[model samples]
Target: MDLSKYLGLFVSEGGEHAEQMARELLQLEGAAVAPEAIDSIFRHAHSIKGMAASMEFSEITELAHAAESLVGALRPPRAGSVPRATVDALMAAAERIAVLIRERGRGQQGEGKDLTLLLRGRAADPWSEPVAEAIPLKVEPAVSLRDRLRTVRVRGETLDELLDVAGELLLETSRLRELARQAREPLRAALDESVDRMHSRLRTLHQRVVAARLTPLSVLTDQLPRHLRDIAHQLGREVELSVAGAEVEVDRAIVDEIADALLHLLRNCIDHGIEPPAEREAAGKPRAGRLRVEARRERERLILEVADDGRGFDTKKLRAGAVRRGLLSIAAAEELSDQESLMLACLPGLSTSDRVTEISGRGVGMDAVKNAIEGLGGTLAIESTPLEGTRFVLRLPLNVALIQVLLAEVEREVIALPISKVLAAIEIPSGHGRTFEFQGDEAPVYSLGSLLEWKEIAAGSAAGRPVLVVDGGGKPVGLAVDRLVGQHEALLQPLAGPLGQFPGLSAVTLLGSGRPVFVLDVPRLLEA
Candidate 1:
């Protein structure tokens, strides 16, 4: 039998089991040894070992066997509570297993390292003695034939192709509808009805396909506790990670793009935000610092927050750092509010750390995190109070592939604005169009014609011109357009090659009539 066919299955199942084991080990490190947790760990290790052995992956099999032995020793009721030393050893073994699995998946064999010494050193204790057999007894040779999952994994590229075809169909349907509008009465009615039905069905199908590509944020976040545990241990600090809204689902593409940003934020929380246990205690706070990561969906956007209850941003230090680093003049730095001074942390190569450390102090990570979030059509903001805590809030689009846009004409060109950012569109009176009362505050309004430097279609009269009230970085701004072309379900195709560098525009889309329109980056446009 050609066992190569099972490669994908083995890697997928084995990877999942490894991740599960790592999470359980982190839990075991904190809580007293539960029979159930140990049993769960044993089963995962056994499964990986069997799968690896069947595939003739000797290194993986050996490592898994070692981990399995350590876990098995704890299974017996006579075995006392697990030691922190044992947990550390298993975590190391699990991390190595994860690395090897990824390497093998990429068709590269890992360089084997003898982990037996490490495993035996931790596993040998009063609870159990090391097995003296030179060669350990093997369990079942064949892999487990379990059918638990009802779903199959599809490659992202395949899904993208499906979406592209759907987009083309929608465009063609719209063209047919336009042609139907020009037909003779009786035939036109029939064609119009049919085209409308097709359009509705296509829209539904497109939505379903897009939803299928969404995975819960938990998929990326569940493994973070293990990382935090390792980092906290290394830094000699006690910190608790509490995650909420892990169940929130986002586009797989968005998840992939923000994974690194999320990691960096978590690292910063540990390294910079959370103080050491001794310091926390000295400050009359709990010995263990708390870090919270929460994700929630609001309207068409996903909001993620990473917060730490520790020593908050010291604005004075930040302002001094900014001035010293030449990011801001001493006079300007002194003039900044505490909030503005705190924002300086996002400036590149600016750190408030007294000395360099392995994890941070090179002053590189936070700015990259902000850039990564913004690159995904998102905005990142910071909030902190001295001696209280710090929170980083990221607002991101729910899906990058498809978006609801308000189509409008500017400078005789059709432009798209994300509907999520538009609060309302209203017709403004001629003279009153210069400014609008928003939340009891006067906000200056600018017409697209004036902003784009195009000759106004109705230069003298603005009696019936549409003004879009938009949330511009938390403040309302009015944007006037020549005409409100109405709402559209647009397939956002990212600009490629040289055009990708263009500012004030994130993507372009083709209307059902085959007319291409640029999708404006409303925030960037407002700033400009």
Candidate 2:
């Protein structure tokens, strides 16, 4: 029988099992290895092995069998902590199995060399077991049926299409309400009530659809511990990795975009932040350095922090490095405060490392991390205390597609300012404001019309034009607009083609009236 039909199932189920095993192997490295953890890992390996054998994937099956044997020996829990070497071997085997599964899914045959060497190397281990007799596998219908009922995985593209349809329906619903308001008295009242109910239902449906796109942060963070373990081993450092707020959910798309940036940050912590065991002990700290990755939601933003209690960044060294790298003049570097000096670390090709290594020291790390975070329409902040720790904070929008914005009329054009950036909207009295003082620092205020170079048609008095105090970087600036149209939920769409590279504008949104307005890129606009 052709096993091609089961390809999707194998890829999905096999991936989940592999992830589970990887997590359990990391846990097995702890001082106390739980029997349940071992059992869970064994079951996952056994399941994958059986599935691969059924599909005639010999490489994957052999690797899974080897992993299963190694884990099986740890099942009885009669020894000290699981050996680091055993965990490394199992992790490598699992990775190879994952690769083979992906290759088989692509209709490519595995070379089968890696598994041969891996198994041969493990053959002499005391825990190694003889290949067992094949047992006919039996599937329980009830368990299978219940699992099927529990969850269904849908492609992200399908959800995006559904959201698009829902958004269009919402727009049409808004149009109907507007039309109903203009109808004759009796009919107008009836239509208004009906439209209200319809609008409410549509809003509810839109919210649920948006919620469906959210995946817990744990889905991305679960593999991090294993990664940290590998990095620590490679660097000969003893680092303890802990993660919090794993249950916090954000858009799946955002998670995928930020994964690589987070990986780089974690690696930087291992290579540059965390000190070796002996150094950490000499510093009066624990032998195992502490690294914590935490995520949480604050109103419209998701705050992700990666903190390490190791050797924090040295601002003086950073300033010297910046000057040496020609990114800054010596006089300019000398004038920078501690905070400004620390920011120099994000400069490209500015490393303080005396020697180059595989992980870092080429000085291409932090700048890329900052760029990646900013590319997601987010901000990155760094805080460090020498010998205490270094914390990198990333503030990202909770959802990129839908945003709450303050709709304002700039001259004849309507523009959207993300409400998260708007601190307050106030009216400046005539002769009372050409600049707004915020926290004892005054910043020049510009009208939205002036900023866009659109002349006022009627030259109205500037007695009480609305001034929106907005967070521009860390400083607040006031933007004067003709009128505040009010708050709205806008579906953000990126500009395409020629307009894609526009500096001050990040995205466009369609209003309920089907009018498209540009969403200001606050940080970029401030820089410009």
The local lDDT score (0 to 100) that residue 260 gets in candidate 2 is: 86
lDDT (Cα atoms) of all candidates against the true structure: 0.79, 0.77
| Candidate 2 overall lDDT versus native | 0.77
Off by over 4 Å in 1: 1-157, 172-193, 435-444, 451-461, 471-477, 494-505, 512-516, 523-528
lDDT of 1 at 52: 94
RMSD of each: 19.5, 19.9
Clash count, candidate 1: 0
TM-score of 2: 0.60
Candidate 2, pairs of clashing residues: none
Error of 2 at 174 (Å): 6.0
